[model samples]
Target: MEHFALAKEFPPASEADWRAIVDKALKGAPFRVLENQLYEGFATSPLYTGAATSPARHGQRGWLIVQPVAGASLADAERQLADDLANGATALSLDLNNGPAIRKAAELKAVAGAGVPVFLAPGSSPADAALLLAKADKTIVGTAGFDPLTVFAMSGEVPADRKAALADTVDAALAIRERFPLVTPFLASSRAWNGAGGSAVDELALTLAAAVAYWRALEAAGLSREDASRAIGFKLCASADLFLTIASFRAIRLLWARAHEAAGIASNEHILLYAKMPPRILSAYDPQVNMLRATASVFGAAIGGATAIEVYPFDEAATEPTPLSRRIARNTGLVLQSEAWLSAVADPAAGSAYVETLTEKLAASAWALFREVEAKGGLLKALESGFVAERLRQTAEKRERAIAHRKERITGVSVFPNLNEKIALEEPAAIIMEEAHPTVDFALPAPGAGERFAALISAAARGVPLAELHSASRIVCDIIAGGALDVARRDAEPFEVLRQRADFALASIGSRPPVFLALLGSPSDYRARSLWVQSFFAAGGIEAVLPEEGFTDVEKLAAAFKQSPAPIACLCSSNSAYGELKGAAAALKRAGASHVYLAGPASLLASLDPNDQTAVDRLIYEGCNALAVLEEAQRILRVEELAEAAGLEAEDENFGAFDEA
Candidate 1:
């Protein structure tokens, strides 16, 4: 058998050759149009000719399939744990925030004795670390989830005795390490930053800064540099942007290696990176699309060499996760690894020019920002000084503007919405409770942070109820309004609000707010815009009444508009046809249309008569603020006020009208 070299048969193509072809296609458009400017302050080109040099490698073969388990009771958690491990999951993340109370060591014997690594997310309480350490299986391994910095960032509060609380957290982490040698006691996570709408660069810098703070604190408490490094693990969010997500995971590893070098560690020791799917891109409408988003996120994380990955259920945004949703989420990783063989190679994106370049850019930008945070005294100081919050605010505002203008399209929510799809969510099961355990008051007077942690652990060993222990050990921190970051915002929230308003109107008024599409000229002239207009209105839950065919006569169009229930009308046609319908807008206004819109560019206004142009309220075209236009149409139809008058609480009040950009 002869293997032929294909490259020799084809003539070599240079960057110049590609440029010439692209230039011809672009015509007179600037070459810059082919470049994409990211919010990270860098630009990516359309082509790369060669592979990057010396890319970072994860030095591993496969990622752990981590499934999140949350339940209303211990039995529920146990059932989910067994089901997940039996099906496909190799690891478990126990969400203690909403899980059943564990009062005794035997209660968690099932979880710890399951023989798989367990990640304990103890929520905002540092005392929960003591609970886990008391009851955990001695061989249990993974993160203990003692992250004070992230908790502070999310809740905007610090202990009244901040210094003591910090010291106590370090002490608890050290104790955990002594007991469960393989378990990382402290977690340096980017959840707060990522959830608050920070960019990838922001997440990296903030997480690095927090890790650095923890490393120093652990060292101060008498751990060696290497031991301190080993005691901490990282958790980062993997978004749907494949290339960027891959770069982000790779970049964090590089950044951490640099940190190790700075600390005089001889070798770049392994770091545990736990990647999670972010909720920012999930949509409440057409939720099945979330499965696709989750697949992309899991693929990116695996390719970029994550140690573990967790995929959120597809219906998580709309309602509670059903058994089917959980099964699908778990299998998403299983199929990718087992069938796709994505984990068969290490550093799969190593030589790709685009990914490598992006990785470098992200690392450099994040390092610079990390240094900025360090110069401000640290992550905490930056937060207190409002530097971090302000930066996040700017990025969030920019993102919201892009989303409103349709520059950042959210499929199924802001575009291509299906209003008629019936979503039948399964009702959550009623939680069955066991007999209550008698509460024990294990109060200690004026103990130091270390002593308090020890007492909590001892109490847990004695089978004191978790609720009682939590109440006894609760730490009240001062609330800092100026330093608090906003809550996690979903990209589809604004449009979902409009849909809710329309639903309210339909229930109260026997119809959805309608928009009359007064298409001009023949079907060939207005067909495209008519469909576009209908879909656009459907996104905002408005029913667009499109004509079967276009009308060249203004009088006929106005008569149709008057006969319809729509209070708003939009003229849809070709630019030349729009020019031909000189009195269309004026006629619609005269026919009792409260507002009239033109479906072409504002440049067409020059061709219309002065009276016709003056009668037009707005222009509906690509790149316009669709949210604002929809809200205006809703206002013209009085959707909100009418619902209110019918004794319905208008949900749109929570989301104010989007400012037109």
Candidate 2:
């Protein structure tokens, strides 16, 4: 299991206390006494002192929260934009969906408000670009235009006059730059790398290299290095890995600062960092799980230092997210800001050893990769030569292998206890293409590498190995190709179902403590008793996953054993009953679980027998020895790292700002 430490300085004596804090804090309650809002205050202390800075403070204005529109109706998009603007969204991502939508949104002058920037995502049409500019300021626009090689790959019948099709993207970009001085519209879109399964580091390195192409292309067109540097921005992925996300963004800006110096560009101004939600973590089943994913992504984005974050709606795992999902998507940023209080500070990761070490490692790795891309004649050439794509293909394959082996656990879809709840998606789906008017003048041909990708992989069609057959005309790197069938070979053996254990173990040790405490009481008493049990668990670890109905009966006991400690146990029950079930508890004691509590009258402790074990250890009373209990749980976790954690203390702060460390 990946190990984690709860920032040794923030450490409580036991896992229960640590977890209790997490639960209390995450409940959106006030825990500002210990950590700063958005994790900022305690950053300077020794334990958290070395933590790296969070993205929240990277820019004085804070990261922009954006949402994109693809193939959605202009009216719908305009409405969405209006809603986002009203709901605290930092920016707009217009589709041009087409010319009419562009025209329609541009005409809604009051909606955009003065100076609220709009960024056109990659692959945007010039006409749509013109429309966004007309409506509001769009100085730093983003694009997914095919890089020269991609253009080359897609270049089937372009006339020699339009050979400029490749060169003209820059020429057009320059013209727009002169007209819109603040605007930096070029290649920072995910149309290539992400659509093709690239790694986070690869994404950063390749995107930087591609930007180098625009610089070289513009330099050839008589634009100086300064202007070229001004034209490119970066859009990257923010998945569930918090440090990885932060490192990727840090690497980009750090590289950009260096590359600008190499290219003779003045000022470290204008390297836009655009981060987007990753589709890889999304699951089609019980789509609501996506909300959790997007939340983590946004949190990662905030920590990673994204200048702007585009939250993919929860339903984006398969279909276009509807209005409701989109609203949730936009509101996620708000929730993080208002409810979660994420935007109140900057560089929230600062002073953590793990985040700091990881940042340096990632930056170093990405830097080396960037140099390699440059060695291969820059990103465009790297793409054309299949080097970048092939390298990323390997990383993606490795990740796929890990998932198959069960090294990576995807909740709900993978390892866990079973559930039989029927999930019928009652929500409506959004239109695929309402305003997808990409405005490139000359028509481009097929994928320079002619292969198609799928929208989603169904359940039954998983586990089949990929077919490697390819035609000469295809961009056929077998390593980079998808499996022939939908079924994916698992990283581990398929899970087998079994009946749950009979005896339940009640363990509680962290905020209240994390012992898989069993509340073997009637439904009425379940809630009341479980409260103390949960408090006992939280005083020890992460938040508890309470049973839905919160009851522990015969069926419940069996179900609990699948996850909880084993052997049947009870809380607040009589000694006679406790002694009657000692055999079951004894058997459970032999297996794994071995505790039962009375929570009954104090007189019972004195009356219990030797086998009934009137021993002080057996009939311990609550509120009597809180300190000893706390000490014991700490010893337990000190040896175990809570199963899955970053395992380092305060790794984020070591950067020393501008590489002082």
Candidate 3:
């Protein structure tokens, strides 16, 4: 009855008709060639259509804009928290480091008095939670029992008395349940796996498996399945891949609902999901681009039905965020909510056939992996057995390879880079310390441990030091005593290293690394590859100095080369023009060029005279390893190596030394 005009005007196109139209558009190319295979055995076709049955609908709306306060002192954190709350932030996340200035009970009171919900990092112990609880009775708190599994996975050192520590944390949660009804005692952080190079499916499967483990533990401690579910929350990472991030959150909700149903929990409560922007994808060189990345991530998280979202400051990778940077980050969400009207719609991607198809496929893949982990004795055992780590490593390696070869582009990193820009780096604030107090750990209390909770509350009331309150217990876990797990290296780190070498050269010798370009043929014939060579050099922080005119004479090219200050030279021209410059490489080397790179396909190397004194030292073309090429260029320019000239033998034979545009 409402606006049926469009549907009545045109008939829906069938799949076969759509395929036929696409085939015509593509000429004779195979349609299957467009299918993309993603990690964790997920593949997406070029097109998707609505199914015979509609997918589930997402009914939630609005997400909390969270600001993380990372300060050296309680005062610094409080100041930032107050400012954020005064602005547009709806929640505060406090990240306490291992400094000696442990937050006192009075300071904790002041923080909670701000009248906003608070989330403490796992670094805070149960004793810390107790102190805050004693001071504040109204505000909701999270991470009462920081999940020790995260610590075990990160540090590879099982905490002493792990079982007792976990029990005490749960008892504390149960003790304060009535006073703090919204407190979440346990956090299942999939962000850990995400930063460690795990794919989206890995993050989902690992988080679900970890949730089951925590639920079982809480149940053994006498908590009902519904209560346990209430006490737990999830933290996931948001990536720049917008649709994948949206689908991921939907998959998580569907999977959790199924799990809850299986557990016979009748409550139709929504799961608490906290999504944070990932720092692994951020770059320090062009941090401005990070703002764009964070914006996209926040959009995806909000559309994906995340309950709360945190956007990392653009300059987060360089230093502690300044006040201005924090404000910018906080306002990003404000603009989205108030101006963009993002919060007005719930599950914005729900009805889209593509998103629904993606969600269904991703959910199925994630559940399969989750079951496999359960069969392998749960998340802890899977991690300890190195099964989870191995899968993440393989995926990370493949991704890194793609990025290094320019198959995947990171703007301002392995692609179009601006070398002249420099940002002022700030020093992190100094940590302040006070006298320490010793902590004591006791045995695991029995199920429904009200007596232990009373004891803990009494101890906290007496001003007992947090360290003394949580002294080591007798329970120990040797299974997690191995070395820490490894994640993939950041994609921008290699290019940043090259930039560092160039910076050192600029500071020490007063000149950045320079590359001379020898152009041939008409401007229209060679302009594209010539600009390609410029961008390729810029990616490595190398300045590509071009000639005023195309040189057909080898002598004239050598003369121009002798006038240049750069030690390296590259040839840029059309395939036909390449035949005209047969002696150009030798002449340039004779003119004091340290190395000559030919900008073309690898097969062009065969066209050169093998016996010539100056055979092409390397080829610069598309899909080559940019990192390896930059390292070799640094060696040639004596930026990294002074004793040896860069050799051609180490370059990729089938490709080139550097990436092409």
The C-alpha RMSD in Å for every predicted model, in order, reads 4.4, 17.5, 5.5
lDDT per residue as tens, model 3, 122-216: 43555667666666674555555356576567766554554553565566667766567777877787766776778899889888888777788
Ranking by TM-score: 1, 3, 2
User: Model 1, 1-661: lDDT tens per residue?
Assistant: 2786868888998989988999999998999999988878788999875755664467766888998866657787789878999998999887555556555555877777777788877233545666666776567777878778887777788777756646667776777777678888777888888878888999999999989998898888888999988888888899999999999999998899899888888645478898999888898889999999999999999998888999999998887887899999999999999999998888988889888889999999999999999999998778777888888888788788888989888888888888875454344545443344335466743444256667777888887656666677666678755856776678888888788777776666556777889989988898898888888888888888766678889899889987676678899989999888779999999998778889989799999988898999999898999999988777777777655556543344322111110
Best by TM-score: 1
Q: What is the lDDT of residue 429 in candidate 3?
A: 66
Whole-model lDDT values for every prediction: 0.80, 0.49, 0.74
Model 1 per-residue lDDT at 37: 84
Candidate 2: TM-score?
0.55
Candidate 3 backbone collisions, by pair? 438-467, 438-468, 439-467, 439-468, 440-468, 440-471, 441-471, 441-472
Candidate 1 TM-score, C-alpha based? 0.93
Point out where model 2 deviates above 4 Å.
Answer: 1-61, 70-72, 96-115, 125-165, 417-661
Kindly list the per-residue Cα lDDT of model 2 for residues 1-661, writing each as its tens digit. Answer: 2676567566346656666867676687654544422111112211233324433325523678786643345576557666767777777665443222333333535434434556765655333444444444444444423244333322222223333444435544655666556666675544355545556666666677777766777677767777667777766778766656776666677677777777666656456777777665665444677788788888877766677787778766545567899889888877776777776666666656656655655566667888998898665455556675567567666555455434455554433422332233333433343323333222223321111111001100221111110111123121212221111222211221000000000111111113444444445655555564444333222123354453334344435644542222334333444333333332324334434434444676545545434322333234434224433443342313222223323222321110111
Can you give the lDDT of residue 124 in candidate 2?
Answer: 51
